[model samples]
Target: MSTPYEVEHGVTAGQTGRRPQNRRVDMESFFSFLHQISTDAISSVSSETTPQTHNNRHAEATPVDTANLFRLLQDQFATLRQTSPDATNRDFLEALIQEVDRDIADLPRLHGVGQEFLDGLDRVSKKEILKGKKGEEKCPICAVKFNEDPHPLVVALPCHTSHCFDLECVAPWLQSKGTCPMCRKNFVRKKEEKKELKEDSEEEEEFDNMNGVWLATGYPQTVIAIRGVDEKGLALVRNGVEVL
Candidate 1:
């Protein structure tokens, strides 16, 4: 009678004296072949799905560095200007410049007084000041007496002198020129000073560029605003000085 192992292996006990060792070897070989096939199939699938270029993967995942991209585009424009002076090149360059100009125009202008600074200004009622016997003082902005002004709105500045102004008069002034009109004391320090203090723990004297050219480096992200960029390109004006 054939053993079960010999029967499974398709070798009868009567046929050439069934070898148990050979059956065991064949079973081991069969499993090994199956493992190899599985491994090869997995490898093929992975290879097919993988990106051809590592740079392409990185580009898709990472945000573009706009400052560098702008610089690169400018360099290309310069190169094109030097190499090709034909109408086609001229038209392309003009179109690119116009696009950049439009982008610059669209950016939000950095306000002289940020909302936090404006919010910190003390809002005092005109009636309260009159009750305190201090409403006789005149606002430096409009040269109008506080009690007599049509509007009741008033704001006290943080200067040591405690100079106050009518909210209507001072709001516009503060929006453009952040300063105490009475003392000419700066309400908001130059952005450069703030940046230097933040980075180096030291105050540095700010210098202006000769050609009215300034770069808005204080802003973290580069979006070319009207004040930040003119026909001369990317600049910031600080204290009546252009800073590049």
Candidate 2:
């Protein structure tokens, strides 16, 4: 027998709790179908001819100022997220931030995004464009092979060289003087310092039970639209409040 509740909701009593996702939903196919529908709708709307038909379509459809509405929402979300860590324990904010970063960078390849994606990231965060280093690139301070990870008290530098110092080994030393011990190529000390300081600050700012959070500003429009994205990022924030 069909219940009044089930009937109102367009479902039969027998179908209750029988969600496809719970049982045998092919998520990939579902997503593909959704994508197909979206692309089709977009094409239909865009290809519509004549101002009259366009106007009629606009009148018939629900009105939504997508751009402005998105901007407003994003601004609100960014502020709330930025303050989450400071106001609360921080677990909420850190996850949100990472999610935002990842989402911003990733776009459906169907969209045909070019190198423009790389252009959106902050230069300080981008991978150092690797350049070829010269002969037997021996770390001046440590004198070790160039291809492996640095050992304790050994600091790795550009040019595939290792100096016997950790980030702390040469952070201050490099901060004051921006040159690698082995190679004179300018080392990015300020950026590294800021990163280290931020991590430390995040750790100290909240208890262990909470996630570390840091507020960042100056995200690009693309970043806001896609979500928080940078080199290392996630899809979305957890609970609509935190990123992880």
- Model 1: weakest 10-residue lDDT segment is 38-47
Candidate 1: give its CA RMSD in angstroms: 35.6
> What is the C-alpha lDDT profile of model 2 across 1-244, one tens digit per residue?
3322233235543554422221111122222222232221211111122211221333221112222222222332344443342443144334433433443444311211112221222221112212234223432322222332211122354434333332312332232224543354444454467789999988775533232333344764322122344567643443355444
Q: Write the per-residue lDDT of candidate 1 for residues 1-244, one digit (tens) a residue.
A: 3222333234433552311221111222222222232221111111133312222322311112322223333443343444443566455555554543443444422223543565567777657666654577655433445665333456888774357765534543343335564564676675456766776543222222224433465667643322443577656555555557
In model 2, the runs with Cα more than 4 Å from the true position are: 1-153, 162-164, 188-244
Residue 17 error, candidate 2, Å: 61
Steric clash pairs (candidate 1): 214-235, 214-243
